[model samples]
Target: MCGTHGDHGRTVPPAGEGLRIVVVGKGGVGKSTLSALLARQLSRRGLGVVAVDADEQRNLAATLGVDLATVESIVPVSEDADYVEEKTGARPGGGASGMLRLNPDTSDLVDRLSVPAPDGVRLVVMGGVLRSGGGCLCPETALIAAAVAGMRLHDDDVVVMDTHAGVEHFGRALARGFDTAIVVVEPTFNAVQVGVESARMAAELGIDTLHLAINRSRSAADVERVLAYVDRLGGFQFCSTTVLPFDEVVLTCEPEVGTLMDGSPLADATVGLADGVLAGNRRPAGSVT
Candidate 1:
């Protein structure tokens, strides 16, 4: 199935479209917000969308309007001591600083553990690894890395990962499978710097699809200002750029209050973004296999 996008908008996203979309940037740059919005758009379009809350804060659940009880029930697969041990044959040692099985079977883990979400979305909370080293080779990290690198999704399914602040998480193989990456940024020097670094690193990782979305832009001028900043950051192929105006209504976001729904402005904007995202997607769904 080609990702049909005519006047009627996107049809079912192609099955096995190898799309692992990671949303990242500096802290407070709206990574979770963008991930949630993208997931909302994909789900609204009647496509299979998996929203992965990889960030330590676990913020995507709330943004995607998941109930508090469901959100609270999610625990990162890496944190499940018994499961981790069973799969990797390595017991937890305070942090993720133990032996590991490099190629653990993760085929059934995601489906079995993912939290059922609103619409057709599913949520996976891949919590952080408390490794003692900068780049620790531990069981938990290995499991996540193995799961991301080996797992396959249904055709047309899109994986939207909400990453921890900054590009530190990018070093892990779990995030490298993402063919498309969206780096959220605000109109600030620090945010733009992070965006540049994020884009640069993604390019280095051989990820061809890199987009920069400016969050909280007040107007078109502000968007331009952010664009100028990206240009100044000096060299990288940015596939697309979008500006999401600040919505005062979203300031009161609560787990129970709901977001990215029909009445929400954020949802409307993300709908447009979803079109562009699928358009830039060059690979087929589930092509990773």
Candidate 2:
């Protein structure tokens, strides 16, 4: 579907238009905030958004304006023993040595599992992986991974996945088939380091289109510091870089992104970021020097 900005503002492609994005970054760098902003902004533009919380923290739903009661009541796919067993032929917590279907049929899980959230977005929570006796949570991982893979079947839905803080999710191949990856970072060394690593992994996963968001940036110097760090870390190319200013309200607003006004600096910047993603600009990943 063609998107156009008419009198009613920007109109986006309907559900099933198939734009998949994964937002990754270090912990406490506003990854969930960016994900929530993008999901709400895109949904406002007239598309069906499936916001997936692949993080153990499951902060996306709350940030996206889902009520606290609902957020607490919802169970992540990894923690749903019955659903996991039905889909993958193995139950989690059943000892890490059992056989599980590595490639389960999860093409319909997205539709069957997602719950409704505000702004016309559907929320899918994939709980954290559990550690047991040095064994892998292959069943839980496979279930979540396959469910993400299943999103490909929906020709009209746009997916915005909020991954856990760090690069471990990329190791699970959960980022496969995503068209873009947004690596959010603060102006700190540790955050930039994780952002660079994530960008590298996304590129290696064949997600060529990448964007960088410097959250809670205090000034141009903060932006420059992040860019400098990226250059120092061997230069990962991001087609666009957005700086989300440090907002006192955002810091105190808890997790609900809906509290930000339309003209808020942070919210406005996220709108631009969302527009950039929909524009689908392509440039080879190179040094951001």
Candidate 3:
């Protein structure tokens, strides 16, 4: 069912076209915040940006103040549930009759998973039956990856993906679709370790454009220290680390803090990060020197 070859050649993303930036790291490293910040910054610039929540945790929608009931509630693609009838030639909600039908076309499946988001950016929630068994390593993961890649072919302003921590979703095919992989880390042993591991995995998967974003940094010195650690590991492309101050505003914002667009410090840092991404100054893995 897989292995349909398309034009896979690398083309320079057109001017003003939305960039696909994937935020990845261990949980609690503020990946969703970073994603929200990116979306807010880009949108403020009048660019239509979509924030994709590939993580099953479903925090991206909440962070942006979007209430999503189910995966289908967001994704526009045809789901396996939608196929229960077509494959069986049964009506919707028909149990036994739908059980004996053939699966729907892969193209049709991709079409149904695309859900629209507010603003100009679209949101595709990758949470469904596929993520239930193991994770993004399954066939469902491959389908979503294809759909995302297809979306990137359009001239959208930006597509920022908030991935699950620990790089569990860094499947070989999925990683290839991302223009840049921004690994968010805190100034701690575990976060740093995860950053190092994520960089290595991304490189191994042939995701050449890997960069680092240091989150929750108390000071500039702290950001530098984390960069030094990543350099020592020799696997990450270190961009200018964004020093997100430990702000009470971010704390109080809780799960519904979509105010990163309000010219806050966190918003400023995210804008800088987005600028760096758009400029293609993303540091190469192991480019800390």
Best-fitting candidate, measured by lDDT? Answer: 2
lDDT (10s digit) by residue, model 1, range 1-289: 1122222123444456546788879999778777877887787777778888777777788778787777777777778888778878786543445556768888777687788777778887877672211376677776777766555777677888888888787675655567678878888878989988987777667665666677887777777677677668774455556667788777776442245466676666666567767877333321210
For model 2, residues 239-275, the per-residue Cα lDDT tens digits are 7677788888887787798878477889988887876
Best by TM-score: 2
Worst 10 residues of 1 by lDDT: 1-10
Which run of 10 residues does model 3 get worst, by summed lDDT? 1-10
How do the residues 1-289 of candidate 3 rate in per-residue lDDT, one tens digit apiece?
Answer: 0011221222334654446778888889999888877776677677767677777777777677565464325532324445434433444334332233332234343235445444444566666423332232333444455555555334546778888778667655457556667788998767888988986776666555555777788876776678677766653445434566666788887665576567778777777677666655544433332
Model 2: pairs clashing at backbone N, Cα or C within 3 Å: 15-156, 15-157, 16-155, 16-156, 16-157, 17-156
TM-score (all chains, Cα) for each model? 0.86, 0.87, 0.75
Candidate 1 local Cα displacement, residue 103, angstroms: 1.7
Ordered by lDDT, highest first, the candidates read 2, 1, 3
Better of 2 and 3 by lDDT: 2
Better of 1 and 3 by TM-score: 1
Which residue runs does candidate 1 get wrong by more than 4 Å?
1-17, 94-99, 130-134, 255-257, 281-289
Candidate 1 Cα deviation (angstroms), residue 112? 1.1
